[model samples]
Target: MSDDANGRRPSIRDVARLANVSYQTVSRVLNDHPSVRPETRDRVNQVMAELNYRPNQAARALVTSRSQTIGILAASSSMYGPASSIAAIEAAARLRGYWVSTANIDASDPGSIPEGLAHLRAQSIEGLVVIAPQVRVVRALAAQALDIPYVTLQSTDLDVDHMLSVDQVAGARMATKHLISLGHRGIYHLAGPQDWIEAEARMRGFLEELGASDVPTTAPILGDWTADFGYYAGRELLRVRDFTAVFSSNDQMALGFIHAARDEGLDVPRDLSVIGFDDIPEAAHFWPPLTTVRQDFAELGRRCVELLLGPADGLESPSPSTIAPELIVRGSTAPAA
Candidate 1:
């Protein structure tokens, strides 16, 4: 027992005694030493929890010579994918007993990139997870070496250090193919803004799928991934009366387009078909129920933590991974009417 000002505080020895193990066993459990048995580990953990014991982070840091902190440079966190990824990263980091420092930047603004890095640097972050989706961020990182270990979370033609693209191209292809297979030939596209790696990859997949079938595509409407822009895009698209189906880059845009179509007295699936990517949680619960592509943002975030820290249990390197997307069909899409 360690003596506090007023009373004897519970120490590792006390926990060990309660758990019927040596203090060395408690220490091993705290340090996550691999030699301990699973049942013993559970017993020690239960004892610690029962005692409400908290480890001394300062002593652990001194022993490890690490701050035990990771930094996240994320963009478009208001959107579903980025926001979900950020949450997953935070959760994963917490499980590993590491602190997270996050810096948000508007991906469109180039000036904020280095500034965000500087903020994390000041915090002495041991590793970095960069989730900026723009190509320029990749270029900027390449131009100057921060000399800190970092992993990027987007597709880049140039080989970036420890970067993973989640296969937006494949996801987009799946989205387009779904529309095409439903007999929608005159399909228009709603895409994210330019200079974004994900937007570009998705656009490429859409066009490639269409080209393979000799189906010509209309000029795409570029919009930020927002319901407001989706509404604006929907209003603009109503003037061109040729298309019977639309492929939106994300679900919020699809919802906006639906609202726009309904306002124009056009019923979904009866007048037009719509498909969107990133099957957000609300997609299934939407009025018509959206047909969308599902990206595993949670998996992406877990992979980021694994890559930033290290792969567990003889796992291979985490670079060059692209999670495949799945197509979810719903009432929002149908055969061209």
Candidate 2:
């Protein structure tokens, strides 16, 4: 009797025989051999799936000298954006049948970045997906050259790949321009803390919009990405009565800003027009629902895996058409008083 009668785990040979293909053809399909006939490969894969076949990872790794494990090296994933992105990356990698290893570091610590990379290297990860929202993390990674293929989610403008989805600069610019179009000349930007790439990009976009419109911007208040910090920033801005509108780097901050403003007897879109990024779920429920930019974190994660596995070198020169943030108009923003 065949081993199948004993309810043994299915193997590649069994799948090959079931599909009526040679063992070599099965192997080619497993390795994604480009020369293999598409129909034959599909047939082999179908049978393998039907048989609930599982590849021997140890054997495959030994044969190819590859771990078949992808590493997610992330910085400060406590924030919604990074957290959501990591989850999506995991989902995408699973669909491709690759193991995922995660290493999260605090971007505030200069040494944390290297430590995360080292942890992944120890796992013999085939490639890396770096989700560094901070500029310093990228700089540190640059100092330590990566031997294996790595994909990053930050826009470095350096001729490297993995600058996938999310044109944060454009998104920020869109938010700022929307405020400007509403005649908000005295726009105050409550930006993210320094060293973060997204924070810097968003700041640049805010400044660029203010400069082009011949409007002098109020000194930006840089704060940690937190509701409490946003509240603090909002109260502090009240001291400088020059700005009529404020653009926060994230929705959490915007929500806090609104709360603070309410305490100061400021009605949103009336006494102060506010906008934010990321469009977090609660943004819509905030007092006078917030106007914010929606970033596709899931798509970004999917693309990061694709780029890491595929040739991401061609993505060095950014194509802005990749991921466009949609501006969600709500009650938070209005014409300056």
Candidate 3:
């Protein structure tokens, strides 16, 4: 028995000898394996509690075929949705006793992302989770063949297994319907870039909601997912000055619109009611706060992992899973005046 500089406790081997069990048996009991006999498991557990023993994660991984690692292919962007989704995935993976290897990609370029994904595949990863929402990413994925089971946190026209995403249509509808309910007869929409799936989904939802409303709908004002685009678009929108409310595709554009409104001397929620999607961290802190849809991104991560690792849910015409968006009522919204 090796003694510490200040010897006070016995080691795992000592516990194994005292319990009359193999070191492997002791390890299994510590891991909470169901196969261990009840009395032996309890006795080993009691001894471990007394000795304060812990298993090394690296050692455990060597024995199990699972490396306890998950690979994440994420887009590096200032957009709130992608950033929040990565954070959630990391947190959930850590909680499940798995380590994560992330490959940050540029969503605008498909080649760069595929190169990074190729590197991840070389690591012999058990599973892959991709946070791909852009069209370029989709195009790249469509061109490739995957050897391992994986999941995508995206909304695509093509059908695939293990997909988790917020119902963009639902969120758009919620935003527009909220504005319409506030007596805003003329509602303008500031949509995201046309190429993105999220932008298309939001636009579809907005059109559907407006079509359902008794009031007439106006054509959308196009903008990129940036405050600068919104600023420019907002400035142009001021020329018309007919709408009472505006629904922005995302928070960044909404912020830009708010700035533009201020420059034009229009008070938010008073002169012009505005609604935005993705209730980002700073949304509540923005001037007069922002009334937006809260998309649960972390939950998306957990569900994606579960589906990918879960029993064969079967790919024979699998139904799409839709997570509803939450409508957050904040200071930036009010009845149309």
TM per prediction: 0.78, 0.76, 0.76
lDDT, residue 262, model 1: 91
Residues 162-228 of candidate 2 have per-residue lDDT tens digits of 4664888899899999999999888888899887888988999899888888888667788888999
Superposition error at 3 for model 3 (Å): 33
Which scores better on lDDT, 2 or 3? 2
Q: What residue pairs clash in candidate 2, if any at all?
A: none
lDDT string for model 3 (211-316, tens) is: 9986687888778789998888888988888888889999889999999999999999899988889998899999979999999887777676666555234344
lDDT of 1 by residue, 271-315 (tens): 999999988989999879999999887788778888878876558
Model 3, residue 212: what's the lDDT? 91
As a TM-score, model 1 comes out at: 0.78
lDDT of 1 at 293: 93
Sorting all predicted structures by TM-score, with the top scorer first, yields 1, 3, 2
After superposition of all CA atoms, the RMSD between model 2 and the true structure is 11.8
Whose TM-score is greatest here? 1
Which run of 10 residues does model 2 get worst, by summed lDDT? 311-320
State each model's CA lDDT, in order. 0.81, 0.80, 0.78
Name the lDDT value of residue 22 in candidate 3. Answer: 74
How well does candidate 1 score on lDDT at residue 100? 88
